[model samples]
Structure formats: C-alpha cells, structure tokens
Target: MSALDPSVAGQLAEDLPPDVFRTIIATFEEDLTRLVQELQTAHESGDQNGYERAAHSLAGASAAVGAVGLEREARIAMDHRQPEAAATVLPRLVAEAKGALEALHALIH
Candidate 1:
C-alpha cells in the first residue's frame, strides 16, 4: 500500500483552509515523531502496554493523515503479543513513519 493515500490527502487539502491544513500536518509530524520514540522505548523496556498504546495512537494519527502504510504497520505493532515480535516489526514501523512524514510534508510544501 502507498505510504499516503492520495485521495485522502487531496480531500484534506481541498476541504480545509491552507493554514488549518498546514497546522494539522505540522501537528501530525510532531505526534508521529513522539509516538515513534515511545514505541522504541517501550519495546526496549518490554513495556507491552506502553508499546501497544503508542502503536494504537500512532495508527489513529496515521489514519487521520492518510498515511496508509504507516497505519498498517502501526496496527501490526499494536497487535504484537510479545516484545520479541516487536523486534521484527519495529524497524518497518519506523521506516513507514518516516515515509509518511515525508509524504505529508510534501502536501504543504
């Protein structure tokens, strides 16, 4: 799947005022960065609850911004039952977040 859904991005751009859309994208960027860090820390510390919470929040934020790939990865991370499983998925999740951020940034600039 694409990192960002073009239709969703287009709709967001077309529906909101430019400044509002820019603010949304900026907020999403900040949330994405913070959540990714939370994911990493939770995984390393074996904090399953924190990890899942971060993943869940990340998924929702990603979906809000039409970051399909990141949303998918975040879901996977959220569903992982073991911290060991996270080891395999965390890298992909982080990469997806990076791609999503890049795509979202492209929307405004």
Candidate 2:
C-alpha cells in the first residue's frame, strides 16, 4: 500500500479556510487514535461486530484524509468480517496505520 496522498489532502486543505482545515486535521487525528485503539480492543476480545465497526470507521476516516495505505488495510479487515481472518492481518494493518498517521502528521505540519 502507498502512503497518504498529500495531493488529495492538500487540495482539500486549499479549499477550506486555514483554521477550518487545521480543525479537521486535528479531529481526524484524534478520531484515528481512538479508532486504532478500538480496533485493537475489538480484535483482542474477538468482538466481530466491534471489529467490523472499527475497521469500517477507520476506512472511512482514512479515505477522507487520503490515507491510502491505512484505507486499504481497513477495507481488507472490513471485508474479511471473520474475526480470526481479520486478526491475522492486524499486524500489517497496524503498521500501515502508523505510517499513514505519520504521513498525515507531516502533511498537516
């Protein structure tokens, strides 16, 4: 998977007032952190519904921010549905999420 697409985010930011863009990025980051934790918790507990919800949320968030890598992984987890199958891919998904967040952080800064 690729990193966050700054072009998409940059264009999005350009379309908004600077303060509003910052607020959006800030909110995205906060939600992303929470969602990541939710995904982990759901996975650990084998909560299939929670897992799917977290994955779906993450996918939507990443897509909004043009975080391609995380979005792809999230979609994968969301599609698998089976907790065990989804859990098997969590490591890679986690890594991609981290990288995507880092890229997004750099973009905003």
- Give the TM-score of each candidate: 0.91, 0.82
Q: What is the C-alpha RMSD of each candidate to the true structure, in Å?
A: 1.9, 2.4
Q: Rate the local accuracy (lDDT) of all candidates.
A: 0.87, 0.80
Q: lDDT by residue for model 2 over 10-97, one digit each (tens)?
A: 7777687877877887888788889889988998898978988998998999899888888888888887644557557788788887
Q: What is the C-alpha lDDT profile of model 1 across 1-109, one tens digit per residue? A: 6689988887898889889999999899889889999999998999989999999999999888889999988998888654547878888988898888788777784
State in Å the error of residue 30, model 1. 0.8
> Deviation in angstroms for 107 in model 1?
1.5
Candidate 1: misplaced stretches above 4 Å? Answer: 81-84
Those runs of model 2 whose alpha carbons end farther than 4 Å from true positions after fitting are 81-84
lDDT of 2: 0.80
- Model 2 weakest 10-residue run by lDDT: 80-89
The alpha-carbon lDDT assigned to residue 33 of candidate 2 equals: 85
